[model samples]
Target: MKTKISHADVLDITAPSGGTTSGLAVLIGSLFGIAVTTNVAGDTVAVHTSGVFDHVKEGAGSGQAWAVGDAVYWDNTAKRLTKTTTSNTKVGYATAAALTTDTVGRFRIVPFA
Candidate 1:
C-alpha cells in the first residue's frame, strides 16, 4: 500500500534563481529526506534530462545529471513534509513549484518505499 501526506496550506517560495523550496515528500510519521521541487508556476516537478536548466541538486551535491525516474522528498522548507507516489499528471491538485533545473536522477529521496 502507498499514501501521501499533504499540508493544510501552501507556502510562498522565492529564490534568486527560482531557488525557493517547493513541494516535499515524506513517509507518514517519518522524517522527510528530500525536496519535491516546484517552480514559480505552482506545479509538480517534471523530470527531464533536457540540459536547459540553471541549477540542480541531489543526494549530497549539485549538478545537472539526474536520472529520469528519480524521486525526491521535501526538505529544509518552512512547511510540513509531504510524500506521495501519485506521480505528476495523476495528481488532481497542483504541486508546490518546480524549476526544471534539478536533475531527475540527482533529485532522489530514498532507494526503497
Candidate 2:
C-alpha cells in the first residue's frame, strides 16, 4: 500500500538547553522522549516519543531500589527516571529492577496520555 504519510513515533526536534546525546532521556515540557542521536544546542535530533522501548537509559535514585513493574516517572530537572514523586512526570513502568549501587536503570517507555 502507498500512502503520503508515514508512520513514525520518533521525530526530529530541536535539542533543549544543555544539548543531548543518543540514548539519553529528554523532556519537552511535560512530554518525555528518548534521544535517538547526539546534538548540540540549537541542533535537531531524532527522539523516540512512543512505544514500548526496553533498556531505556536513566539515572537511579539514591539508595532507591526498584522492583520490576514499579511505576516510573521522569524527573525533568534531573533528566532521569525515579520512583520519587516529587515534581516528576509519569513516563512509564520499570522493566528491570535497579540496585542501590547502580547508577543507571533500564526502563520501558509507555508514553503518558
Candidate 3:
C-alpha cells in the first residue's frame, strides 16, 4: 500500500489593502504567508502558505538582533519578525543571525497549526 501527500498548499486571497507586492508579508485572519505578486485592494493574489522557502524575506524588529537557532515570532502589528514575545505570533526559528544593520531577515516557514 502507498499513500499520497498533497503539496499544493498555496492559495489565492484578496488583498485587504492596496500596494501588496511579491516578497511582502501578508496576513489573512490568522493565516500568514508571503505575497507572490502585486495586488491592489480587492484583487486576488497568490500567497505561499506552506513549504520550505529559501530567503523568505521578512522585516526585522527595530534595533533587534537575531541569532541562529533563536525562536522567531511574527509581529503582525509591525509587519515584522521579532524576538520579543509580547503579543507576537510564533512563526519559526532563525536559520541565520540577523544584524541591526540588516533591513530584512530570512526565516524558515514553520507555521502554527
Candidate 4:
C-alpha cells in the first residue's frame, strides 16, 4: 500500500551517465499533493528497478549496492526506468524538485530494498 508521505528522510541521489557528474537530485513530498516536477527532462520515470549505476551527487558507491526494487535513473532527459527489482515499494505518489538549475535536472528515485 502507498503510505502517505508525512515526512521523508531525503538523501541526495547521484548517477553517472556519460561521466560528466551532475548534482544528485531528490523529490520529497511537500505540504500539498503537487509533485516537485515530473518528466521535466522527458517522460522517463527516472529511477525504477536496480542495477550497477552511478549518480551525480553521491560518490563512488552511487549504484554499486543496488538491490532489488531499487530505483535507477541513468538518463534525466529520457525519464525512463533504468532498473528495478523485487524489493520495489508501491509509493503513494512519486515527486521531484523543480530543477533549480537545468543542470540540476530532476529528483528521480525508486525505492530499493
Listed in order, each prediction's TM-score against the native is 0.19, 0.78, 0.74, 0.18
Off by more than 4 A, model 3: 1-8, 51-63
- Would you list the C-alpha lDDT of every candidate in the order shown? 0.30, 0.76, 0.72, 0.29
Q: For residues 8-68, could you state the per-residue lDDT of candidate 1 as single tens digits?
A: 1322222223332433332222322223464443344332211222223332333323334
Worst 10 residues of 3 by lDDT: 52-61
Q: How would you order the candidates by lDDT, starting with the best?
A: 2, 3, 1, 4
C-alpha displacement of 66 in model 1, angstroms?
2.3
Q: Report how far residue 91 has shifted in candidate 3, in Å.
A: 1.7
Where in model 4 is the C-alpha error above 4 Å?
1-67, 84-113
Off by over 4 Å in 1: 1-28, 31-61, 78-113
Clash list (residue pairs), candidate 3: none
Q: Once model 4 is optimally superposed onto the true structure by TM-score, how far is the C-alpha of residue 25 displaced, in angstroms?
A: 11
CA displacement after TM-score superposition, residue 108 of candidate 4 (Å): 10
Candidate 1 weakest ten by summed lDDT: 87-96
- Name the TM-score of candidate 4: 0.18
- Writing each residue's lDDT as its tens digit, candidate 3 over 12-105 gives 8888765477877777666777789988989988888765443433444366777887787778776777777888787777888878667667
Give lDDT tens digits, candidate 2, residues 9-106: 88788998988888788888866888988899799989888765554334443777778898888877766678888788888887777887666666
Residue 64 local lDDT, model 2: 77
